[model samples]
Target: MREFSEAYLERTREGMWDDSRQALAPLALDSRERVLDVGCGTGELSRVLVAESAGEVVGCDADRELLEFAGEHVPVIAGDALRLPFPDDSFDLVVCQALLINLPDPAAALAEFARVSTDLVAAVEPDNGAVEVDSSVPTEERLESRARRAYLEGIGTDVTLGADAREAFSEAGLDVLETRRYDHERTIEPPYGEAALTIAQRKATGAGLADDRETMLEGAMDDEEYDALRSEWRAMGRDVIEQMEDRRYRRSEEIPFFVTVGRVNGPQ
Candidate 1:
């Protein structure tokens, strides 16, 4: 599995925290409740929850690299979401963001969430069923391609859980209180645009590009040609961003989850 480095995780944290915090604002947290953040990448959300709730927040993740970067921002520990280190009913609220869909056993993880949370559990997960790509590609092809990529990225079997998250919570015996959709659009600028190009290049490289394509991407182009290629790539990203702004090119979608106070119906 290609785990993200601490640096990359931190970068993502800085860039995406605002949208995450906004997605969480509707949860109506109590000021005195203790919260648990499962898969708390870089402790960004945990920090926000602590500050916002004026309460204690503990974050847990399997990746120590990310947790090391998260040091002291919030109380972070290295552990699996599927088997949390905490005891039953240890936390009043549990919040997981962009974490469940990537787990090998999402149901098991949710069971753990239900186990540890006494009052409520809320999770924000991507809606794979709502994924929209460019109209130029067939929807089925896009879905298959995304599934293959996700599998390669080590998120386990492909399942569209966006519409099923509520059911999952209910199965874990938590009452589903609210489910909302949040739309986010990100615009990459200049060199950052080049980084996107680099990612596509890497994907193509990994996917076995033709000799000419490989050569072009492997620095065979002249300085001017390279600059032109980068410029073209940046232009393409801008175009995609514009299309997304106009609801043309669809890239991502998420269902922000909220489950109210409940208890496990059976043995944990």
Candidate 2:
């Protein structure tokens, strides 16, 4: 599995669930008794689970530090997705958000989720390949794609697994019940906050993009090509910062996430 830094996780999940709940309707959380959020990083989804479900909610993660952070909101335990600490039929509902994409063998993890859950199993995952970015700077559109392609090539797990989670559920011997598409839209606009300013600064300095240079190089990009990309990336960032200073920068991204819900076969 790919380990994400606390900063990265926070950045990606900052405004998630802020605009939508339709995707969660399929879980029928009100009817659930106990809900386990697997690989619950920093309790983002766990908080939502608690809000939506009347059942007991527990957050589990392999990272003790993240678990500690998550513990502030809900009951958290140090646990792995492929090998949950609980016994069979431990919960009425088991779910994970953005967890499957990081696992090399998502099927095995799903099988484990099915093992512990008595009824429902759900996974909320994003299709990185389908990411759409609209920015004031036109170059950002192209750069994002190039960067995303290199990222997908360099990443270890199936980043595009969101669209096929239902297939994996079936393979894990769970009956596919429902699938919902939730578009997590992030808009970078007026009244920019600390995070937005920090991100813009990182881009202007190229330090953040540089962090991913090595990973991008793991694919087909050579050093020269990387240097060129960095130059352009920096330019784009400078423009972004200028726009921010001028109060003219606006950007939006729609990340398509699929919420797949299923049920355990046979009896509990």
Candidate 3:
């Protein structure tokens, strides 16, 4: 069970929030409906729902750091996705983003989501089936990708949550209503320039790439070397961005954002 630290959540805020809001648009939620955002990282999605639903959203997660950030926007509580804190049929809609793949038992989590919601249970997850590896990408960029893959493999969780989510929703007796794919392309800017670098650093640290922090620090190059490395890395990043923008990457499969809706069948 990997816990997201405050620093990591803050660093990835824009990307996470932006994707979540976009995913919710097609849901066509009523302004007055109550919603639950499960495994709501930093509660950004929950915040969007709260604003749109007029403060009728509640978010829950096991990470205290994320919940603390979430508290500023909506009612956030520390709880596990596998076991929700609410009673059955407590929400009109239950949504989860970027969460299913990370869970040890996604089936149980889906069952919980189904139990809590009365009208809908929607989820947005990355489709690894859509992962496009550009051969022209630089060595450092490729290194970063490899590191992420290795890290997810080490954690024994799926890197992409899309496939598993669809199956889980079905197993939980939710009707799959609408599914859409978004090939979101954006130019990541500076200050946030080295997303790949940051990812690599985190994975390295988490995986104990070296014996200890001191040893790891010693192995990592100084600012000068890192800057030089970025020159090449940026070129690769640019190539990837161009491909994504032009839809050039091979579409391995339909990477969909699963939006499901169903009426509660059993007694509350």
Candidate 4:
């Protein structure tokens, strides 16, 4: 599994559930007795589950550092997604967000989730391949897409596994119940925040693309091509900073996340 930094997790999950949570209705959270959030990095989803569910929400992750951060919100334990610490039928519901897309064997993780849960198993995963970006910078969208394509190709797991998570559930012997689409929109406008400024700086220095250089090279992109892309990306970043200074920069990125819910087939 790929390990994410605390900052990266926070940046990606910021304001995740702040919008309407209608997509989570299929989990039947209101009636849940005990909920287990596997791969619950920083407990972003676990906190929301705690707020919506009458039951107790426990978060589990392999990263002890992240588990410590998550402990601030809900009870947490260090555990692997493929092998949970609890016993069979330990919880009424088992869930994860942005977890499956990073796992090499999603079906195996689902089977483990089924083993631990007596009722529902759900996954909220983003379809990275379908992401859309709108920016005031002319080259921003194109550069982002180019970088994203190479990164996706280089990623070991199925980063694009969104609604398709149902296939993994079926392989794990879970009955597919429903799939809901939720668009997580992130926008950057006037009065740029600390994060926005930091991102702009990273872009200007090519630090952002440099971090993914190894992965990008794993794909069809060679060192020469990556250098070319990085040059363009830095130029775009400079334009973004210039626009930000003028208070004319505006950008929005919409990531499509699918909430796929499934039921354990056999008796608990």
Of the two candidates 3 and 4, the one with more favorable lDDT, higher being better, is 4
- Provide backbone clash counts, one per model: 0, 0, 0, 0
Q: For model 4, how big is the CA root-mean-square deviation?
A: 1.0
Worst-scoring 10-residue span by lDDT in model 1: 203-212
Q: What is the lDDT of candidate 1?
A: 0.59
TM per candidate comes to 0.65, 0.96, 0.68, 0.98
Q: How high is the CA lDDT of each candidate model?
A: 0.59, 0.89, 0.60, 0.94
lDDT of 2 by residue, 100-178 (tens): 9988788889999999998889999999999999999879899989888987888778889877998889888899998
Residue pairs that clash (backbone atoms under 3 angstroms), model 2: none
What is the lDDT, from 0 to 100, of the residue 127 in candidate 4? Answer: 99
- 6-36 per-residue lDDT for model 1 (tens digits): 5455543444546555555556664547888
Please name the candidate that would achieve the greatest lDDT relative to the true structure: 4
Write candidate 4's Cα lDDT for 1-268 as tens digits: 8899888888888888798999999998999999999999888899899999998999999999999899999999899999899989999999999999999999999999999998899999999999999999999999999999999988899999998998999999999999999999999998899988888899999999999898889999999999999999999999999999999999999999999999999963
